[model samples]
Target: MSTLNPYCPDCGAAVAHPHAEGCGVARCLFTGGRRLSCGSRHRADLELDHACGGDEWTGRWPGEAEAAEFGWWTCWDGPGPEQGWDYQGQGWVQVPEGTPGAVPDLDRLSTDAQWDRHALRWVRRVNR
Candidate 1:
């Protein structure tokens, strides 16, 4: 058998076992949610309520349509360490920039080096 431990659903922080009963409310160290979950991969049924008394902040991903509507550059495809654009297999390759729905200039680069260089340039331009 496996033992279930409670953890913050938002940040994945561990929660005290004593506070795991009843409503199963656990404060998140990061997001500070009143409800949390266990740090178990098998346990996916968890709910988190923010103590700040407002709508939960649903984080947006890069290239999401919603992010684009808000004029937010959530989409980032570049050759950087923090941007997750580092070389994966075929060396640094250019990924589509801007939001997912937005059209990209397919004629930007021809080779891998060109793609990487252009992608990095584009990311820098948009980020600034």
Candidate 2:
């Protein structure tokens, strides 16, 4: 399932082929930065609407040596790929979108709650 975009920056030497599988990451855009900025950690430059252009880890080149050393793309393959990062309601002040009674309104984050201590993420409380 490895892929790559020849047009992407430094998308050469394989580096395990970065990008071209950038749909899921686009759907789970995260906005938990200091100023509620758009921050999606997708490996490709999908040019999403909510993308605040801060996904350097995926969109940029980590150099040929570093890319092979860490196998970066392998880090995001899972049932819940966006579980650990700032997606799927996972991150600082992020509320899991599927959580029962979970409302994610950046403008109305008046409360903060650790709904899932096991996951160790504090979601912003809206309308609670």
Candidate 3:
């Protein structure tokens, strides 16, 4: 199975990499993807089969283990060479830019202000 692209959780912008720079707006939306209304998309999962080598980060596959829908997963790392899952298509398909709830105009955000964590909104930061 092929993986999908990663997107910003807040504004729905496609994030080139995990922890991509300047994304104060993303929130995780993978949970919504599991619904039938959201296309009932499915992805393969790696069971940390152990044979894949140790956590030493040798950077290789799990030898004999093939792709299986064992569980949910997503790459926090950049796109893997050719793994079943990457940061993008972890366990759900990437919803397009205009997914209803997505922020249509990122420009409105100046980044001059901070997200008012209390109200869950962004407010302009005025200099003292």
- Candidate with maximal TM-score: 3
lDDT of 1 by residue, 60-92 (tens): 111122223333332234555754665443433
TM-score of each: 0.18, 0.16, 0.19
Give one digit per residue, the lDDT tens place, for model 2 in 1-128. Answer: 12333334422223233233332221122332321322444435534455332222243222322323222122222235445444454233323344433332322321332222233223534555
Q: What are the clashing pairs of model 1?
A: 7-37, 62-74, 63-75
Alpha-carbon shift of residue 98 in model 3 (angstroms):
21
Ranking by lDDT: 2, 1, 3
Q: Higher-lDDT candidate among 2 and 3? A: 2
Model 1 Cα shift for residue 2 (angstroms): 34
Clashing residue pairs in candidate 2, if any?
none
Candidate 2 ranges beyond 4 A from true positions: 9-60, 71-128
Error of 3 at 116 (Å): 1.0
